[model samples]
Target: MGCAHGKCCNRDSSTSDEHSGHHQRGIRPYKNKDGLTQRSLELVHVPSHNFTLQYSSLTQHGYYPDTTDRENQDSFCIKTQIQGNPNVHFFGVFDGHGQYGAHCSNFVKDKLVEILSSDPTLLDDPLKAYNSAFLATNSELRDSEIDDALSGTTAITVLVVGDTLYVANVGDSRAVIAVKDGDRILAEDLSVDQTPFRKDEYDRVKLFGARVLSVDQVEGLKDPDIQHWGDEESHGGDPPRLWVPNGMYPGTAFTRSVGDSTAEKIGVIAVPEISIVRLTPSHLFFVVASDGVFEFLSSQTVVNMATAKVSYTLDFNACLLQNNATAYKDPSDACTAIAGDSYKRWLELENRTDDITIIIVQIKGLSNQSVVGTTDSEVHSRPCQTGGSMNQSAAIVPPLMHQKPLESVGHSSCSFLSLYIYIYLSHLFFIHCATRLVDLPYTWFLCFATCVIFFIVVPAYIQPLGEESSYYLCFLMIFFSK
Candidate 1:
């Protein structure tokens, strides 16, 4: 692992002394004073002082070695209590590609935070700050001797300020949130993947006179007789890649990235799409990872794994009461498990593995202090839903048409339809209560009469119909439950 500015911060003096042996054994942080002056070390354990935050992060080397003598070209950083701002927290994962990518990622990891923290504007307009920081970092890299023409990194960063979360990304690295929705946990992508496949990216690069082509398309230029090609056809069906016309240099898969001066001439810019969402009681946890993990797994898979492996349990009543502390859970266990699983999955591939990095951040839930006394029977007494059965009182909506497993679909669609339905129904219920029942005069009585007929009277009228009338019963149950 490479450190920012070639220095790691050790919390314990004894640990620093212990690591001196490793330094002697040729595994020490470098003393690179060029470019960024700020220092950062890999695998530094940073705990929170203000909030109950438990997080874990890890990085692994890739299967193929680069000119830098290291296979991994990824870097990450976690900082809590930002400049004494207890509500402010930061998490970042940078995935580097090209020859000098390691140095590029490390440089950004060290300097970007320093620039954001020192600048006063970040507090007023976070989006502007994020944008400026990216441009500044890229500008610095261009002036530095790190060879931005041959090296660049994808940046995905999350800034949590009180209840607001601002995610900014300029590359394929992703940030996703796991939200609690009634009986199930839902996953929401906070950052957009800026690959050549995205229409906006493709258009932007085309405007800059760049050609998005596959290796097969470039090869087809040699054989004009080739009649037609599939949309995504490439070298063995590889994804279409960005390239500069008349040059075979900087064949990057992603459209937006930092410190790629060579690609910039051909329209690869570092502008990030900033995503903002408020942290609510329903918000569970979020994960920030490099493309290595996402290449093999979907966002929902990452969310499910993180939610299950998290050390804290989700408290239903606590969430309803808006007592996030009770629902809060630490993510150290989750992060560790995800890192191991990510590496394992990568190893399962036959050819090679990319650099794997994962950072799991707990959102609304605080870490569990300790288990006290016996487990609550009331909490554990609820019957879990079985795979084969649906509650008779509930609607009998048929299952999805496709019975194939998630693996069959390559995990592209992680069953987000269920999440969409839950959101849509909740929104409808709220809209009815707010616009119809509360504001309309005398309409409340009409609505009540309708509810009574649909829920109470209709159910009584159909109870004796038995299995033959299940479809109608389910229809009645939908309104009744609402």
Candidate 2:
């Protein structure tokens, strides 16, 4: 419905100055290690900022809903130390499909950190590094056969540098940044869902003119190409219109993504533009949450919830109230301090909620705030109003307090590890049972060996980092299975 009259979400992307040199670096390149290829990692440090950061994820039915994870593949996480880079940290969501998000996670979890620090030039141009990594990963996928193609995963990662937050995404996975000044504003949408009708997705669809037609508009793809003559003056070229079946829209579903190469050639879509934004204290908080969380709540509601937390406190404990008042001297319970019940509003406001995942990030900002719920229409609308200073109506915020790091006086690191281990054990047990809901084929089981081998090459330093001539045994397995 967005591009009915044509004018898809197109961008020159040139006029806008790319803060970090935008000279089309070669597509991302990848070199596999012995037993692995793609990987992602996370690094967080407290450089005198009051905040609590955490992340959680859940799938449709707990990974492959058809297999017993206890005896098979499982999801993983890696935390690495960046010697010189203290403020630079990484957070990623590698969502695997077909088999499970584990393999995809494995491939990227191990490499994300190394790639970012690989170049001495990274600090000067993280965007270049970001683009290269994506191209590098996609290039590796090109070598695998079609079956492996179906096994591809989407990636969404965030990096926080003081006040600036950058995100690079591939596929449907997404990233959200919530800011709090006086009021809450969705500072930026690091990534779009890649759904067909979204404005920015228009050009990608028009690019896929006839191929989608060959599939016969089964999904949302259909006959496009309408003359978009805007008074024959303002606009001239043939504006691409959304094609439909029975002359109706909603024919094709996804327009752009990583694994949809099969659709890209038929004039379907192209890769998505990496999204970026810098943060300020004006907004209350920033949440790098996933769609599961967004699907249920509007950005403003999230801000309001955080703000109400501050307004009510209106007063600080005598001892700590002194110079720093932004958060509880202890930030872990920051959310608890702000929202007494912890997003209780989500339950009452949203139409629905999935595995709500969020990273509660605290920054410098004003104290006056709003209490918006997930259902607030304005919050659900464009959470972040684009362009810079023009958004004055939004809450004007200044850092409320100076900062201080919490002192873990007698905390035992081992105890924390043990607690997490126990919790993870319980989660794994439940996920194992939940996986039985989806029916998988015998081929998926039989090709396990081949699948293992293919995944193994993802992280190792294999040459070319782009194309490959290998289509091993699993290639044959794909044909037999179908």
Candidate 3:
């Protein structure tokens, strides 16, 4: 959200070896002012942009949270311009308090795209809007005393425009896009997992002189009785610690997030570094999911299942090829195969740590959907294979034939004018709310109303305003101009 600092463009430090991930357009790996590749990630498209889209989500209270402070949230969004319209279909998962399933139940509703397209500027500078939204929520919670010592959720949100998709995130929720390079990794990550894994997070702890721990370290810290207990009895070692602040582990945890105002003061909460990856033609399916799902399966494992051809509509759950121990769709029912399947679906009440949600997108045929319903829609005969291999047809690649048409896009340009105006006004109103400069319930109402007008009415002014309103005069001018 910060103005372009010309820092992400580390040309002098770029490494272009075929083995390196440098030289990716105007986008090279952006090291935070901290100088680290932990934030460096990439996005790629495969074959061509055409592809089919589908998604499913599930959640359960693993061990307990219906009464505890632990919270979890998992969400993902898929927007396809297949309808070839300006509107975008956005979705998100708002996993809440890890104690029970209560957190994520209504989160999806609260987590929708704020319909800001009405304000082109918000849409254009989504990063700023995103940061504003996060900080704004934190401010509100702190002011209202709504967030005391508990309650927060992790979020994973995705946006797809034409073939370009974007991800913005906070907390531990994650976004992983599959690349189509002969079954290789092509994910240009848009959201850095706000794990305590980064060095800055570690330094921040050191700043407060707090302790840190990966999930594994947490277990080790326990059971002081076991002197020098160096992984002798542990099977998989230790799980990564979810947190590393507040006088705990001294290394890493929590770089940025929401509802953690107290934690921020204590230096546990962090403002996430944003990552933007264009879901071009070369990119294949994208997996925007929660850690719950990851706990049950590896990312590539899910990709293998999702990309396998199926016989049911990729959007439905009944047709999903659950571990049927791994199988393919029947030839005739191929059209009805679920776009992606999940063995780790959230419906199971198995005790654990968090909620599970995932948005799976298939490439190649993803660009447009023409309502393939009714005929053979009920058929879901699983294919006869468990091989998690990429379907050659599902690979995506950005095409030169239909590039993002060139345009003179600038602040003064008509295309950008309306957007920035909307941004300025919306930003002004929120800045007031965020800073509590005019804080009040009444003021809240006013701010909300202003946001509505900016998105809904601004477009009209953008089109031919200031024209004289006279029947005869207008007709004469039109005639003369013609």
Candidate 4:
């Protein structure tokens, strides 16, 4: 395989005046050796024999009040037709940290996927291919001109081949899937975070001479010998970090990452934890995001927020009436909601936020066909499984955490009344046009034309107007035409 490296360009140092707006300074177009340009996000449609994949991504710069204007360290990649195969797709999110974090992230983001796409054996043995690609990409990053002695990135990626999904993760970034269980949708974790909180990871790093201690412990504010931190959640005190035994330099919170040369000596590795999941009709969508989004939000909470934007009915008759239409929520809207909510949560807690990036992929067209891939035993052996049974009785969250319903009749009463009045006026104008075009007795032609507009033209505009707007428009059109 040919490994072609890409160089990072100089970025502007100026910060945006609007602190609340989406951070645009960190988004720059990167061109690899193949002359292919990679941007922050790309909107694409991948069609397969059994299902179609639709994806959207969003990134926001964090609020760093203490630093002198820094660029966004979050980077993402979306590639379709991997190795010229239409059934294969790739998506990734990288969260960089340290002084030269941005350059490290962008380099790895471009080269990692490129290496996997160029591999010949990727299709036959995805597990081996994933391991080789990650190790090779780490070596390439270390050889690059970027100074990564103390800086590195966390990567969470997903590769789709036909009906199977291979998720590879390092560091703290995470991937999650939404499984439809009867009437409720639930979130299942695709990757477990590699941090000191995991007992196995902590023991391995300690065996390699790493001293795990929180900032407070390192500063002599607490005892370093005592290991008292609990799991990621409910770890009420300062989180444990890995540092050199003798010095306080190169303290990293994650147990695994790419290009952290100083921390690598203490067992922080670039190897990824790969999970294989077979796509079924019950699998609705999946989210790949940086730790920024999952910092304060639970996996279940994130799934609920993503699904709230999409209105899905569990009734078989309703689905049959609509011809089994899938994807009620646009993926882009879901990305925006996740990013925005994460940004807000960061500001609320620490007054500063981490770079937030999110990618949402919705699975469609699998309802009518049987999905083929790995056996159930292989999938359940890892952290991949439906979350409904686990979180069935999860407590309800406040309305603020959920996405507001799309404005339409029967969904938002205020909007419904306003739309009803607007349609009544439009009906009068159409009746007048009918009278001018033909006799009053032959006005049924106008009603037919109105039906065409409401049924055909309006549905096409539903995405732009909001997904639920079409139903309400059709409802009002029928009432006024009568």
Clashing pairs in 1: 328-365, 328-366
- Where model 4 places Cα greater than 4 Å from the true spot, the runs are 1-48, 309-328, 368-482
> Tens-digit lDDT track for model 2 on 235-318?
222223334424333222345333334334443332435655544345334544433344434444444443332332232211
Among all windows of 10 consecutive residues in model 4, the one with the lowest summed lDDT is: 382-391
Q: How many residue pairs clash in each candidate?
A: 2, 53, 74, 0
For model 2, state the Cα shift of residue 297 in Å.
Answer: 3.3
Better of 1 and 2 by TM-score: 1
What is the model-wide C-alpha lDDT for candidate 4?
Answer: 0.66
Would you list the C-alpha lDDT of every candidate in the order shown?
A: 0.57, 0.36, 0.37, 0.66
List model 4 lDDT by residue over 233-329, tens digit each: 7665367888888987677878999888889999999999988776777788889988889988778667767775344345311111123333336
lDDT of 3 by residue, 76-104 (tens): 33332212223233434443332111222
TM-score of 3: 0.48
Q: lDDT tens string, model 1, 36-129?
A: 1112122211222112444556555555322233345666767664554545678898886765665667677666777777777776667788
Where does the lowest 10-residue lDDT sum fall in candidate 2? 9-18
- Candidate 4 has a TM-score of 0.66
Q: Whose TM-score is higher: candidate 1's or candidate 4's?
A: 4
Candidates by lDDT, descending order: 4, 1, 3, 2
Which is the better candidate, 1 or 3, if ranked by lDDT?
Answer: 1
Better of 2 and 3 by TM-score: 3
